[model samples]
Target: MTIAARMDRLPVTRRHRVATVAIGLGLFFDLYEIFLAGVLGSVLEKHFHLGKSELALLLASAFLGMFVGAVAFGRIADRLGRRRAFLLSLGTYSLFSLLAAFSTGPVMLVVMRFLAGLGIGAEPPVSDTYLGDLLPPKHRGRYTAWAYTLAFLGVPAAGFLGRWLVPEAPLGFDGWRWMFVLGALGSLIVFALRTRLPESPRWLAAVGREREAEEIVARFERDAGELPEPVENPVVPAESGRLRELFVPPYRRRTAMMAVFHVLQTMGYYGFGTLAPIVLVAKGFPVVQSLLFTALTYLGYPIGSAVSLPLVERVERKFLVLGSAVLMAVFGIAFGLASASWLIVACGFLYTTASNLFSNAFHIYQAEIFPTALRGTATSGTYALSRLASGVLPFVLLPLLNSAGAGVLFTVVAAAMVLVVVDVGLFGPRTTGRVLEAVNSRVGATTDQEAR
Candidate 1:
């Protein structure tokens, strides 16, 4: 049996749990940073006396940084290895987040946020790919969703912390500043935890370090104590795939599919996930009320992730993405039309839930479709384009919000989600139970023949 087949047949064990938690805990900070823009935007506007354009810039800074980080680290991880790339990404984000806390003015804050984003951007794609490399195919989506369930808790954590800390400086430091400090400190701790975890055995084997890969797999076998019969799979030659490979057939179509999915998905996902408070404030809620409502709405994130766990393995991933996108469009539009407070929260919560389902499905799908050699590069490159859209979103959406009201803002978000549905429905592959290499091999062979 090949090393990859042995890996696929292994049962869930302690290492899996520890690695998932460590990565998930680290993702908590990544998510906190992503959602921080919405929570901090109103406060910063008041504190810094920021104009609309300046507020947009502040909100977009980390996302812009994420764009650069994802693109750079994707290639780096594919070369240097996932462990090194992830550690550097987390460390860089942590250091800059701490710096962001001390900024004396908007310029310093924006710069700090942008710098921190470099780490933030690489995290999700790298982590997802890392998890994909580690987990068995049957359990892959479910466990990945498990990690995200823990990670999405950061939304409410950010929301409530903003509600509590943003309204008052407990020890004389600004509340918003304290948010950055807490996030940085928490991220550093996760970074330390992750250092103890092993690199992806699959990634090691992919890079031709079969000795290291075997050693790690041996450890997992020891830890697991007993294992099932190993299923044999044909090993595709593990040459390091280059960036240009993704632009070729099979991968090229998958890449294009994800590229469009990521770009459009952000507006719907971040529209409700990151910009909820902004929308609420525009709906005439006071800043405090907006934060509280946003926090309440964010409760759905972890819960939704949890709910998607069983469905992730049971349902076709592409269909999950499609279904969730449709729900988001519906709920987001409902949120725009809601006038009552409970109705507003209800709509917001539903939108958030659908957004996370969409998130988990796509995160797993993107990583699953590619060969491991190019996984990081492909995932991050396409994901970076999403970050670019995320950074550009506030600039576009905020202006639309100001002119057309919440109804129009979310209507635009709905329109984006509609496009996402069509893109994924038409082009995305079914990735529920297929072995990763087999999936790619079949895809490549089929596409190569078509090209002939």
Candidate 2:
């Protein structure tokens, strides 16, 4: 079948929506664990008698583990199949989170958190690939945005839980430990819910499980009351997929652009995310006040995602990315400079909202840019680079913050945002309503040769 015809065959159904929600919940918990670490930093310091540098190092360690997990599991997802890979990553992270609660020292905590980060990193790209491939083009932007928006809800959920748990130390357990425990328990719930979910038809087809793929697609069609047109019989090649495919010809430039954008974007993202509360405190707020302010800032994420849902489908993907980056740069600087608590909060709200908007766009953009054959692997590999950059920032940037100031930090972050705007806006092709294969075909012979 022609690419256009295949694109037209996409089924929009209740099953797809159900799958998106289930997969999104799993992602929410995954992100919850990552962000919760920052919330518990002070408690960890008090419990372990850790200095600032030591605490920062512990956070960095988890991100390093995430880098490994994203690259490793991404390949595994592409090769072993998405369902198995998703289940394995989820199980691995949840188990490690539970284990982390029993840590007697920083060493054990760091080790466990690192292992958990590996599991956490594997999920987003894999889930993005799975969701993007399944949804019809017409709803792709909104659905993708909703999925990421749901995942980010975990941020405020962690904040709310931390606000309560950090003070009480329920059951004589460390409040931070409770966070890990709750995360593990939540993962169990996600695992149970996911068992009812089915595999991606696109993935099955890519791997040559045609009958299974057809059956899955048929189920979705039944749910939607409209069937997508079937593609020609897929040819199963010998090579499953490889990391090297990301760097060939047409994809090479795009890959490089995305890598640079992710790196710079994350530097700004982590810079602000890791230090938002600190900035709030530096503005003369008390600890509790700062935490509350930070929580309020994060509360804007879900709201931002929801607000963007209506426009995501209407706007060009690249435009959304560029606009958000510019907004983050502006609000980030404003957030750093504001002296009044109310003004600071307003700036922070805008910054975080813009951050979520850009983030949602990028998640969908990255997954849709690659072919089914290489989607998981490429997304994982590229995203891993961002994680690696983020891992280093805490160690390097935090010290700079101590010596310099919020102004310097925000300025640097703003510069990074500018770079992302330029890279994505200039180079990113319009994938707004195109079929996955059609998007891939535009990537050209270089990517085709690499796919072989």
Candidate 3:
């Protein structure tokens, strides 16, 4: 039995849950910072007296930095190893977030935000890749969703914190600045915790360190107790994870699909998540009311992720992406059309829920599509497109929001979701219940075609 097969056959264990929680804790800060941009939008605007372009610049800075971070750190994770990459990314983000809290002006704040984004950007794909490497195949999707359930809590945490603190100064320091300080402190704590985690056994094996891989898997087996007999899975020697490998055959199609998907999906995901407070303010709600409503709506992120736990493994991943995209489109449009407070909140909540469902599905799908050698690089490289689009989104959507109404903005959002449905539904391969090596072994043919 190969190491991969042994890993696949192991029962869910204490070590697995602990690792999931540790990675999820890091993701919590990543999301808290991601959503903080929307939560603090109006407050920052008022404080800095930002014009629309300047405001857009502030909104886009972190995403732009994330674009670079995702691409760079993903490759770094592939080269240096997942454990080291995790520490580096978190430390970079934490240090810069603290700096962001002390910014003297809009320019300074934007610079700090961008620097922080470099760390934030690498987390999702790396988290997905790491969790994919850690968990057994049977419960892989569920545990991944479980980690995200914890991570998504950060969304509502950001919203609630903004509601509480953004409205006024606290203890003579700006409330918003305090938010950054808290994120930095929390991230630093998680960084310390992550240091204790072992490297991915699968990653170690692929890198030709079989002894280390065996030791880690042996520990997991001992911790798990009474695992089933291991199945036979041949160890396909790992390919050199060259950058251009992503541009070749079976992977090339996947890379293209993900790139297009990421670029468009941001319009539906971050389109509302990162801009909702500002949109509510545009619709005549007071700034505080907007933050309150946005916070309420943000509650769906964790809830929606929880919703995916049962469905992520039961349903086909591609179908989940399709269904969630449709829901996002419908609910997004409804959110714009809603005139009553109850309806607005309802639509917003549903939209956020569906978007998170979409998030979990795709995150799992992307991580599973590649082999271990390229998992980090491929996941991060394609995922970077979303960050690029998100960076560009403010310039496009904010201007449109200012000139047109929320209805038009959401119409554009709906259009993006429609394309997402097309992209994933038509092109995505089925991955449920399969081991990672089996999914991406053939060079020219995809797992979907091979299965067929």
Maximum-lDDT candidate:
3
Better of 2 and 3 by TM-score: 3
**Per-candidate local distance difference test:** 0.89, 0.79, 0.91
- Candidate 1 lDDT tens digits, 1-452: 67899899988889998999998999989999889988889999999999999999999999999999999999888998999999999999999999999999999999999999999999999999999999988889999999999999998899999999997996899999999999999999999999998988888888899999999999999998889998777566545587777887667878888899889989998766767788888889999999999999999898889889989999998899999999999999999989899999999888888888888988888899888899999999999999999999988988988998889888889999999989987777677887888768854447534533
Cα displacement (angstroms), candidate 3, residue 41, comes to 0.5
Q: What does candidate 3's lDDT look like per residue over 1-452, in tens digits?
A: 67888899998888898899999999999999999999999999999999999999999999999999999999988887888888889999999999999999999999999999999999999889998988888899999999899999999999999999986788899999999999999999999999999999988988899999999999999988888788876455458878888888777878888989999999999989989999999889999999999999999999999999999999988889999999999999999878788899999999999999999998888999887889999999999999999999999999899898899999999999999888877777788877887777673244486554
TM-score of each: 0.97, 0.93, 0.98
Error of 1 at 224 (Å): 1.9
How displaced is residue 171 in candidate 1, in Å?
Answer: 1.4
Please write out the lDDT profile of model 2 over residues 1-452, one tens digit for every residue: 53324434666567777878988899899888878777776567678999878878887877888899999998888888787778888998999999999999999999998999888889988888878777877788888788778888998888778777777778798777888999999998998888887877777777788788777765665665655456543332333466676677557777887788878888777677767876665567776677777788888778778778987888877789889899999999888778888888888888888888888888888987777878888888889988899888888777766778777878888998998888887677777776666567644433434543
| Candidate 3: C-alpha lDDT | 0.91
Where does candidate 2 stray beyond 4 Å?
1-8, 226-240, 443-452
In candidate 2, residue 412 scores what lDDT? Answer: 86
Candidate 1 regions with alpha-carbon error over 4 angstroms: 235-238, 443-452
